[model samples]
Each structure stands twice: as C-alpha cells, then as structure tokens.
Target: MAKPERHPRKTIPAASGPTNSAEEAKDGKDAGYNAGMAVFSYIIGGIIVWSLIGWGLDYLWGTRWIVLLGALLGAAGGFYLSHMHGLTRQGSSSGGSAADRGPSQDGAQ
Candidate 1:
C-alpha cells in the first residue's frame, strides 16, 4: 500500500509574503457597489423631491399638467446630475493616461 503524505498543505499567506488577491478584488467590488448605491440614491432622491414640489404646486394652482411636467423634468435632471457627478467623475479619474484620449477632430490635418 502507498504511504500517506506527511505534512499537510498550507493555504499560503502564513509566512507574510503577499496577501491573497481575493481581498483586493473584494475591495474593488465593494467600492463599485457603494458607487452604484450612491448613483441610485441620487436619482431616486432628485425625482422624489421634484415630484413632491410639483404636486404641491399643482394643489395650490388647481392644475394637473404641472405634475406630469415636474415629474419628467425631475427625471431628466436626476439622470443628468447623477451621470455628471458619479459616472463622469469616476470615469475621468480612472481613465488611464491622457494619451488614451482619441485624437482631436480639428480640421487641421
């Protein structure tokens, strides 16, 4: 019969070399999750606030279309603001070197 192995295999990192890459991966995912949450919150918050304001205005003026108008404007404003402050900012920060930008489209060849 074959002899059993002696020492058990260790899971590494026990000697203080390089930590597992899983930690870094988890951190990146957490950051992305947080960013997503923030974006969602911004969109939801903007729309709700504006919609409420519009509803109040309609109640005061006894109008109906204003609410619809307000909701639409609120959605547009929310999306615009979210993209501007969240996606655009993050993209710019992580957008590698300036050379990554495509060549300018100026007419001067």
Candidate 2:
C-alpha cells in the first residue's frame, strides 16, 4: 500500500491595525537621521577646530595664505572623515545610494 503524504502547516500571528508597525518604522528612520546629523555636526566642529589652528599658525608666521590653506585642508579632511564615520555608523555606504531590500510601507523599494 502507498503511504499518505503529509502537508506542512503554516502559522500566522493575530494582530490588528497598522499603527504599531508604522510607528516602529518611523522610529527606526528617525534614529538613522539623528545619527547621521550627529556625525555631520561633529565634522563641522572638527573643521572649526582646524580653522582655529590655522589662524594661530598664520598669526605666528605673519602669513595669511598659509593659514587659509590650512583651514581649507582641515575642512576637506573633516568632511571626508565625518562622512565615512557616519556611513559606518548607519551601516551604509558613503555613496549616498540606497538599495531596496523589498517593498516598504510607502511603496518604496
């Protein structure tokens, strides 16, 4: 005699309303934004510090261009460093591009 085939059973959770999920998703987005902003602020602060150092150097050497160059270099370095740090924290890339893992609530993929 042939044996009967058994079927796999699936289970679904009982939940109502979309509010809970929406709120949770929004919180996640907010957290990411806040983290990114914090990193950006730190970068700006670093740039300011560099500018101050450049100013001091200028004053000591009696040369304005040298100080200006230092300030510019510092700003560039700060921006690069901050961008990398921010991306790393967010678990993303510095390319500013996002890949869709699947459909989101907003129909974004």
Candidate 3:
C-alpha cells in the first residue's frame, strides 16, 4: 500500500490577554455608581453646610426662615455645580459640536 501523504498542521494565533466581558461590565457599573455617588454627596454636602450656616444666621439675627432659604440656595448651587460638571464632561468626551458633527438624521438642521 502507498504511504499516506502528510500535511502540515495549522497554527492558531494566541489571544492578546484574558479579558472578561463581565469584568468590563462591572467596571462600567462601578464608574457609574461612583459618579452618581459623587453627585449625591455634592448635593447633600451643600445642603448640610448651607443649612448649618443658615441656622447660625437665624440664631444670631433672631429670625426663623433663614434656614429654609439656605437649604434652597444650597440645592440650587448643588444643581448648578452638577450641571457645570456635566457640561465639562460632555465637552471633553464629545470633542465636537453639532455643527462639527453633521446635520440631524431627520434632515432638520
């Protein structure tokens, strides 16, 4: 009987690294959680600090409603801070404007 012909084996490329999708997802989740916590902390901290100041003012001036004003101001300041931070973040990430990007997909400029 004739000898069987031999073929060279194919070589598979090695993976770059052992990266896991679950780990990536977890990291994304953690980052989101951290951001949310930071915003919450900012708001809460603003409220607490301003409320204390207001309370002190109320005591010093013998008024009753300054604490409420302080709380409102704190809330507004917190929202403004968060909005600014969000704008900054968007600017950094987007790196472009609507004009730079093309027109709307719906044909509305």
Candidate 4:
C-alpha cells in the first residue's frame, strides 16, 4: 500500500519593487529602539558606577552627602557621554561624512 502526497494550499508571490518601504521603516524603527536603549544603558551605568564610588567615599569619610553628589555627577556625566557618543542627538555633526550628506560646494577638500 502507498500513502497520498501532501501539497501546500497556497503560495506567496515575490515582491517586484525596486525599494521596500516596509523593510526600510522596520530598520528605522530598530535603529531608534537601539539608540534609546543605548542612551538608557549609558545613563544607568553612569549612575551605578558613580553611586558606588560615592558610597565608598561616604563610608570612608563617615558622611552621607557624598552619595547624593556622586549620583548627580553620574547623571551629568552620562548625559555628556551620550551626547558625545551621538546617542542623544539626531542628525547632528557626529553623523555620516560629507559624501554621505552630498557633494561639497566649497572648493576645499
């Protein structure tokens, strides 16, 4: 005895366009999500590290205000780092090169 063969009920056609807007939009969303995550991580990391240092200093100095100062400094440092790393701003000077932006009108290279 032989068993019957199975077949797919439906088939999907391939896309024929030069560009895929859906894919591009997905990529843009992913990039934005990644940037947001990076910013969050930077801020959190700074806070943790600075807070730890402040805690240690406070313990050694027998004081309770150093931890607060450390937390504030960490926050400021994190924001500065994020801005420097281009995670805080969009389309800023840290973006792509001149060629990516477009041709240079100025004669200098």
Candidate 5:
C-alpha cells in the first residue's frame, strides 16, 4: 500500500506574512550556531584544562583518583560558564531585538 503525504495543520498566508520574521529567523539561526560552537569549545577546554591540572597534582602527590574528580569539576564549571555567558545572553538578545523594541523615547526628539 502507498502512504499519503502529510502537511502542516496550520498555514500562514503569503500576503500577511510577518515583515521581519525571515530576518529574525536567520539571526536566530546564526546565534544558535555560534552558541553551540562556543558551548562545545567551553566543555572541551574545561575538560582538558582540569584534566591536566588533576594529572599534575596526581603526579606530584602520587595519587590515582584526582583526574576523574577534576574532569567532573571541569564539566560542571563549563556548563555553568556557558550558561551564564552565552546561552542566557543569546536568549535575551533574541527575544529583545531592534524590531521588537518598537521605538525609543529619544526618537521623538
């Protein structure tokens, strides 16, 4: 048996499409791409730095457990930093773009 094609339940009319939606979507896509790259870099960088530190400490102290601990700590710190510095900021910026700002009070002057 052949299957039928599926389509979206709702449709937007071409004549009434949002003015800046396309631009906003593109901006969002770019922002998301950048954020993903930054977050990945952060995680990898954190892991490598902390693991190195842990390895150094183990070497100096002749212990075998610190490297795993360091990696965990690094992962946590990376997530925290990425969230604080990138993801949250990106969300706020995307939500409050120039188009959404309407107008400024100084514009009347």
Candidate 6:
C-alpha cells in the first residue's frame, strides 16, 4: 500500500498569563456598565433637584411650564456633563502607555 502525504499544521503563540481575550472583553463591558450607571445616577439626581426647584418656583410664580422646562434642561445638562466627564476620563486613561503601543482592533491604540 502507498503512504498518504500529510499536510503541515499551523502553530499559534501560547498565552503567557492567566488573562485572555474573553476576560478582557468582560472587563471592558464592566467598565462601560459602570460608566453608564454613573451617568444615569447623575441624571436622576439632577431630575430630583430640578424638580424641587421647579416646584418651588412654580408655586411662587403660578406658571407650570417653567417647572417642566427647568426639569428638562437640568436633566439634559446633567447628562451632558456626566457624559463629558466620562469621555474626558476615558480619554486620559486610554491615551497613555498600553493603548499607544500598537494597532489594536478595538481602537484602544
């Protein structure tokens, strides 16, 4: 019987540490979740504070629209400020060291 030819196999580099791609992805997800939660908290807090102020003003001025408008503005501003802060912090942290090392698929580089 004739022997069959075997194809060569490809080899991949082994991981050196306990961490892997899945763990990194999970960590990223957790960080995003935390950031989102922080923003939500800020908006909710602003809504409560603004609602009180709006109610007090409406009571004195006898205008209902002012309260609604104030609450809306407060919520928008709070969300914007929170989001900006998050971006600033993320930018600062992501701009240094590891992120600048190479071309990363996740855009961290």
Query: What digit string (tens of lDDT, one per residue) describes model 4 on residues 1-109?
Result: 8999999789789987538789887887898899999888888899999999999999999999999999989988988998999888756454786678886678756
**Candidate 4 TM-score to native:** 0.64
> Runs in model 3 with CA error above 4 Å?
1-18, 87-109
TM-score of each: 0.60, 0.53, 0.62, 0.64, 0.58, 0.54
Model 1 whole-model lDDT (C-alpha atoms): 0.76
lDDT of 5 by residue, 68-103 (tens): 889988888888899888563635543678768777
Q: Candidate 6: lDDT of 35?
A: 83
Query: So what's the TM-score on candidate 6?
Result: 0.54
Q: Candidate 6, which ten residues in sequence have the lowest lDDT sum?
A: 86-95
- Lowest lDDT sum, 10 consecutive residues, model 3, at 86-95
Stretches > 4 Å off in candidate 1: 1-19, 88-109
Q: CA lDDT of each candidate? A: 0.76, 0.71, 0.81, 0.86, 0.83, 0.78
Candidate scoring better on lDDT of 2 and 4: 4
Clashing pairs in 6: none
Greater TM-score among 2 and 3 belongs to 3
Give all candidate RMSDs, comma-separated.
10.8, 14.0, 12.8, 6.0, 10.9, 15.2
Error of 1 at 69 (Å): 1.6
Please tell me which model should have the higher TM-score, number 2 or number 6. 6
Q: Which tens-of-lDDT digit does each residue in 51-86 have in candidate 1?
A: 888999999999987777777787788778878775
Worst 10 residues of 2 by lDDT: 88-97
